[model samples]
Target: MAIVTTIRRDAVTLPAAELGPDNPLPPLRPLDEMHRIEDRDKDDLPRDMARQIGYEPLRSLLPARVRDGYGRERAPRELDALVIENDRLRATVLPGLGGRVASLFHKPTGRELLYRNPVFQPACFALNGAWFSGGIEWNIGATGHTTLSCSPLHAARVTAPDGGEMLRLWEWERLRDLPFQVDLWLPEGSDFLYVGVRIRNPHDRPVPLYWWSNIAVPEECRVLAPAEEAYHFGYERRLRRVPVPSYDGIDRTYPAHGVHPADYFYEVPDGRRRWIAALDEDGEGLVQTSTDVLRGRKLFVWGTGTGGRRWQRWLTEPGTGGYCEIQAGLARTQLEHVRLEAESDVAWLEAYGPLSAEREGEWPGVVRAAEERLEACLPRERVEDAYAAWRPCADTEPDEVLAVGSGWGALEVLRTGDKLPGTPFEEVTLGDAQVPWLELLRSGSFPEPRRVGPPGETLVAPHWRDMLETAPARPLTEYHLGVAQWHAGDRAQAVRSWERALPLAPSQWPLLRCLAVADQEAGHHERAADRYAEAFDDLCRERRDDGETWTSVTAALGREALDALLAVGRTEDARSVWYRLHPVTRERGRFRLTEARLLLAEGDREAARAVFDDGFEVADLREGAGAIDELWARITDEPLPAHYDFRMRPAM
Candidate 1:
């Protein structure tokens, strides 16, 4: 019933249109300029100027005209790519695109399971700024795609002892300065593709990290998972569970019904054999099963609204089709930082491919068919044997294996030091630096203020300074340095350090607030307003323009930015900023109260009263209820009541 077009894996190439001047990929930021931008302090600029500076490096720097119609007339050409295949499945890897699997085809069905973007269209989506929207983006070291997501990776094709070809892709995560590698193994006569990854923390200190496997699928698809409950990631890091697929008057499952888009983190109930799929209405899709190493799965849907469609267009070309992400995480959930010990390593195995289905909407039949195919071709037993045959780390043997069982999947080593008493695996040897750093992190003894002598003689330890100097130039390091400098009474240097750090870790509201407060304390009200405005923009981006209101440190900063702007007599700027904040922050009561106050300041009592009536609707959600009353009393020209604190705080 379905027409199929078979694409030869060998013939596929980077389309000529994608390579020419018209469709120019973002020119790589020069190393020196990148470093310079990384180290520059951005807190002093106005809000718009600061954003431009923050986002410019992430763009192609070409005029809009040049980038708009860049690849419209180009043709496909053969490129030097890594093609791995078997009798039933084929995958093409592009070493240039962070070794992403550019094309994955189910040979029998001739269906391209993974969404392959026709061009290397880098956009401002990733946390580190530049990101592409196709293929399986290997995200490690952070929540979003790593800084190198748009860059090339070190790749090599090697033959396993069993004579199977393996494509190895590796890159050093510049942000965390960690080494990570993913090995793609497609055994002969198999339809499923096995992926094995190892991430190593080569430092002597414990480092916080995250790992996510982001696989893109067609937009008009449903995410299938064996999840009974789903956690909705909300503003201010709020996570609450709702029934799977739908809850709280919201249908989270795709082909989403509501206007508000959703990002759901599903906790895989079956620890032994967890799997997830992205299938169409007819049950045709790709199924991914991972060993117990990957504990969490996430679904990101941008919905079919105008804004969502526009964002999808920005990510790819118009009519090229939009895609959603079915992601897997190493930790319980993304943004939940896991501490990796020094000189330590973690590895996991996963397999994915097309599911065979006989009828429309037959979820069970599709899953059964996929399992049968997996069993017939690359069974769990075969996977374990293959993984055990080729050990990943040459210098050491796995002392402890973390896996479900013999036939569940490949064994992974999550922890190395001591083997469980009844466990089957051997104890892994660890580097000498591992235990101390682990202990330090566990005891919360990292870079704390030290008492050098008697009372009031406290100062940041010299070792913290030493670590700051030698650590990778990352936001975390800069933050620690700023804290140390601030406590050491070097406020100006601390502000500068935090300013440099803010752009690197834009989502950190506390850091931004700290810089803002420092400027406010130093009598730089305009600079303080800029810092708060920048923080507000970061929060807006993090919330993805959907204005479901929740209170967080960033939300607090948004309120402060408004007050600071008004304090400096920048009424127009305050009004402009408030409009941008209102849609995303959605603090209806707070926005109304602010609007009323601004109107009253401009001698508009009737308008202020009208706003006050609207504010009363959501008064219960307002944090500064007393402040609202005070504003109301003032607009009515009434006398102030007994001592009242108008200082605002986040409604916890």
Candidate 2:
């Protein structure tokens, strides 16, 4: 005979020991152990493993005020009965996704549906039953292609108490045959409904358990996340048009800041999931109540988009806001760990839908809990709302409600009109026929006719043998051509071309620098030195305005340029430039030490030591100056040189 029993009539008692701490996203193993449920096997699992779990686990971190009217803190009872909703008799459907029956009477168990009627691919199983094939295996669960995991067997059913008719069962074939309209429901008017799931770590070592919930928010509403406080990789390009905010709320301030508003992912590690009042502009709120950081299993948080071509939208269009993805895991990056020897899985997920329009008097003391949770995910005082368009009220009118949070409200609004404009860098249009002057020079194809006699015959000997004297392109282009000519062993022609380019071309730093080098190559030492001197002076002027301290690399480059100028017979110019930099160089630690070497070259031993003694302030100069001091000591035993070879270098 089969054992028969009715729903236990006795008031259900929970063992005090089973009730874990009142926290967001509580662990599922405690409940599973109490109910004697088998844990889920770590075989091929789903991608979006984080999405399989609901958002309820994060609720425990909510302010006590907001967590009110939810479930009471209770211990687990020995012999727990996992209740399953069997039919749609009392189920209620939400606003979107028509015909998808939801168990309205049953308070969400906080346990989410993981693999329902899963169909396996040749190698894997579907995690979210959408795009990805889950983490481990790629199983196809579409109609007519039902697959099941070989290990950690799962069973589902829709039935009344013992001896009652079966409502439904977790069978792939059966679910396919039945309409998607079917839904499981909790008893009528139940304040809280509890569903349990088992996480089986079949492996010898522990694997991570991850999950996420698909909570739908209104299109008009926005999301908030603490990007400045949290490590955020800007917007997901795949989900651009998808509805949702980039970040979850940072805190309960008037307006938020430091978030990119587009596709961005926010990861909260285990023991870090906590936030309060995920509210919309119209005041729709979904607060996190608890989180179960399952040991050895990482929790993933995700915000899905309703519609878009890519995973994230808003790279090109900042106005296009997408969903916010809030997740908890062992690591911050996409996927952290999985061992062949470990057992890890995402267990439960619950979504509390659109709350009452007016939530009054802070739910209950959940503020501290919520604040703590925020601390785990981000630093204190970092939470902020999403970026949105701001509209100011008329200044002429003295309004009452408008003045309440107006001071903050004004700052909350993000201005969209001030984006930096892009500039086009194409050549000015002359005509469809554009001349390729650089190409002409490279090809050596001068269009000007060759010297010919009066009879139009090629002259055996021409009055002038200069075939190409004028440059065909812009002055800078011609300058480049001159450099190429010098490399090709045509020094005279190169020098002539450079002379033409110098005055015709505007003084762009790059061009001026290049011209200076060209003059040096042409052996016009005086001209090269003058060019370098002019360039260095200009750079100093530019940097002086910004008060930017010069780096060792930059200072070295500048010194090298100065040396080059002095080498080219512009010693007086180099000295003038050097004097201007002396005060600034004295302020710099490394430059001051290097200045000592310059002093030694000038036969000023006392001056060199003065700088070396005070050069400790120049952090980069200490080692070299120290080495020089040691060498100086050795050299003191012998007669010091009248003048040291302090190689002067030019400034870049």
Candidate 3:
């Protein structure tokens, strides 16, 4: 059995001989709100400076410390005395060792030591000076002299040779405590060492301390958090949707880590958290930080392009590489649900001898022993307790009609096992803007709405498609009729339903859009082109009145519709429709670029250049610019090797 200790308060005071000037230090604050690092705004420098520096825009106006005639960025000056120190511990001070050592301490040391040096840190204890080049600071230090109580928390107490709650400072009895005061007396050739921290809590009052340390990484490193899905967001712009898929374990190189061309947002709902650990094949161990505790109330992760820390050793090559910082904490906006309990806190943490640190044998054994001790200290039930208890979004009564938001509704119902109420998709309310209502319905949490009537007779084709006789207020009815007719191979009837919808609901884009597809399927290619052109015109006119245009939907689908028009040799119609897309949008150039290729096929090289140039000026469309340039090269009679084998990338 482990040593049994008692709880106490107002215990015997330290002897006059042992009490130093720095003894009886100030108490540590609770770590309840420590995860608010993101809430603090970074200093804003001039815009010109920001553009000039690209991303590392923070001006280093603080005077550099001149050390031995060389200027060095300022950081903690002493560490050996201000913290637990060891020769092996000294090796980890290189500003990036926290990624290696992520664990908790299990037991408290019982003895205090009288110091000869009287400093917490050794002179050589500072880690490698500069690593993260993106204006983020990464440094560690210990105070040279500060009073540290044996036990700041009164949860447990130890009795020793001196008396109750008093720690003996004498040398060790045998092999233990080898590093503190007697490294020279150890057996020859033995490198093993032990440092101790004496702790006692004699008071009945609870002890708390907000213990935290940070590991920074380069601003460019990609961060991946486990979410049901992900969306890219540029902080400077209103959020623009980008095409990134949830990581499916099918591709190797295009794995979650490599797909990041821009910064992304990973949405972890309330009562859930994500662990975004970095992985570098280059020696730099992953930079893992959390905004809040994983398995806690709420956890968010962010990686800004501006400034961060880097690990030199983790570089792919000797002098070139990127850094990834994983910040573990709660989110601010869209995450007000996450909060900390008033009294709960992280009492102690250990950071050293990284998970990958390889020693002959004893190192791992020591770590295992330390972990086992920590596991034994906490009760099994509370081992994984979150920073705050989970709570439902709103109050509920038995059998009350309730509609859960699509994205998180399923999870909420799953946990509570509440009988969910049904709503028409059009009637459903979704609080979150990130996920669509259709997606939530498809995720298996909600019941699909059944139309009021069923078993209607299918309409037959021809008869001049009499369905166009119906009025437009019945778009839902016509839409259903159109789908049924299409499945029945009555293309004419489907086209009539679309034609009826366009006249009744002249502004509805979907009706004309469907008619275009119906026209193509019915072998009326010319008619299809006309319908697409009409729909594109409606969308452009609607945007003038409503500031919100269907950019995401149209930007993605319009190019597809135009490509179909071109496939049937209707290039003129394709060009007219392509010209309507906003030049600044992400999909602006794809259709026009497609047209350029079509012009090149017709031997019109100069016309294709003018068309490509119009849409290629947008910076976001640069991805498609390469394809246009290649086609231009081929059209201009530039000699290029045929049968080019682009480096293959495997993807699911």
Candidate 4:
């Protein structure tokens, strides 16, 4: 049967909890998770590896806001999806959900190659929070999942290298302020799907670049990659070189062999063709390979442990099957960031399809068979040749725009007058968030908010910061300038800018919160607490039209204030903030956990225990976080309940 590939608009209705409005608060915390690399066998690492690790550590998420407003209460919501299909396969992509390839179906085998998430449950997994599991997720920002994890992407239909219509998703990543696009196409009647990714550094200065294409396959599969050794990074916060296929006296190829969550970053030799595969017992499954530019491949296993299983359940529905992730990145490890030269861009072509291998064959032999079979099925040259064919067409203007993402990209393009031919950030895509920045770009003046409320989103890129520094000194300008200064590592100047902005600010909460963060960073806990309290008070006093949404923001701010208050031994103040939260907000699992913490801090152990007795699930429970179990153990020297035990580390 002859096949013709096509793209169409679609929707998937899942029991999804909506991602409520992002917290207007700027992310002031320095990311310390990457710095926790254990000292075990530290001498084995490169001479300057640890020293270089300090470079490009995520300082703050200034332009992006934290997305913690989601709750556990899910309803059937229809998510906008884009579908691309041909004779042998069908792929469903959620453009609104970070352009996640939500499902890939193999027609001949009647199998789903990717772990299609049964539900869309936003968790605190992404960099800016609110990430869902499963499918192929593109991580473009530093070390963590991209801030766009639960956000939308601009999508359009473009002419493929093979003359078929391909789906392209593009966005301006605010973290590094780079524009990237992913072009996905399947040749007619071919089992393999080709993904061409390009990330451009539009500025004259060099920028740190990070990109990882994460593919989730069922846990029943045995993962394989051509590497004699792999770097094992665990929740123990250590990276150690371990022998591949025989780590810890077991064939670590299978995801089910372990009892703790971990990452096995395959040390694929310099000359090797980069690939990773996960095959079932019958040795038939998906294999992903890319051109040499993407040098790294990794297998992430959420092992058969309590915490891992709980996380699997939390991501989707409990009854659904669990899965593991096989990833490819530009750097050897996710912890590292590669440098993109000024005005240069990196492009790569990736191929995803099915492969068959000897099911019961020995360690290296089965992997070798899979490699040989893959070569016979779809040669590396074919992928390379496809990449060559797609290069010129990459700039082919979209014939039709299917979905619109944030206006930030359009704003950037307008400011810089970047002629990004193929991936156009059209003026029509600009919307509310980009309004003030647009005004700033059009006229030399940055407009202040018309009402006394939380400030809109902030942009801290060097260009925007330069503009803010030169703009007229108003509260909004000063506040934004302070943020840009802090992002630029001018700590003292940032503090001074906020101090100048606070008193005359229309709404004082934003500036006060920034000051609170600064004070906390400087080890002035009492001063931080005082400022947090003031910020929370000012927010509560405001009467706004966006009552429920404002309440959500207040709840988020209240949590931050409560933590600072607790740090200074102000339990009563923390209690006051907790009680001030709306009933709906207070009922959330996150707030319930906070309430329990406040109770414990107030010396009411039983009260905290009772809060736990009413079992609740923190929808945004962080990866490797076991706070519930710790709090439970504190109240009573009891074995942690199975449902509550979310520790991903070794039992030792």
Highest lDDT: which candidate? Answer: 4
lDDT by residue (1-652, candidate 3, tens digit) is: 3222221112111111111111010011111111121312212422332232232211111111101111111232321110112222211111111111111111222111100111111111111111111111111111100011110111111221112121111111000101010000101111211111211221223321111123333323222334433333222222222232323442111222332222334444554323332323331222222223332111112221111111121112224434333333222221122222332222211111222111122322532333343234322222223111111101111121111112222322332344321111122333332132223223422112243211122222221123322422265446545644554456687678757756665355656666776666567877777777776666666644222234434553365557667667776666666676656443433455676766765568888766755544211121101353366576665542222111111121
Greater TM-score among 1 and 2 belongs to 1
Tens-place lDDT digits, model 2, residues 308-409: 212222111224343332232222222223221243322322122223233222322333444444345333222211000000110011111100111111
The order of the candidates by lDDT, greatest first, is: 4, 1, 3, 2
TM-score attained by model 3: 0.32
lDDT, candidate 4, 279-354, per-residue tens = 8988888999999999889999988988889888878898879999999998778877778899999999999998
Q: Model 4 Cα displacement at 313 (Å)?
A: 1.3
Across 1-652, the per-residue lDDT of candidate 1 in tens digits comes to: 3222121224455544342112121111111111122224445433443343343132211111111122223465664566777777778876665667877888888899998887555543444345567888787655555555555565554444255556666654644545666777766666678887777775678766678888989877777776767766532234456687667665565645534344687866664456677877776888777777687788877666544564565556679888888888876556455667887877778787886443234444544565565566456676666556545322232232211111100111222333222122222322322332233333433332132110111113344455454555566556666765665567788778777876657445546766877888789888888877766666655543332122322334466778888787777777766676545344445566677777776678899878755533221121113465467677776533222222222225
Residue-pair clashes per candidate: 8, 113, 36, 0
lDDT of 3 at 482: 64
Model 2 lDDT-worst window of ten: 386-395
TM-score order of candidates, top first: 4, 1, 3, 2
**RMSD (Cα, Å) of model 2:** 29.3
Candidate 2 deviant stretches above 4 angstroms: 1-155, 158-188, 191-195, 204-210, 222-228, 235-277, 294-333, 338-652
Compare the candidates by TM-score and give the number of the best one: 4
Which candidate do you rate higher for TM-score, 3 or 4? 4
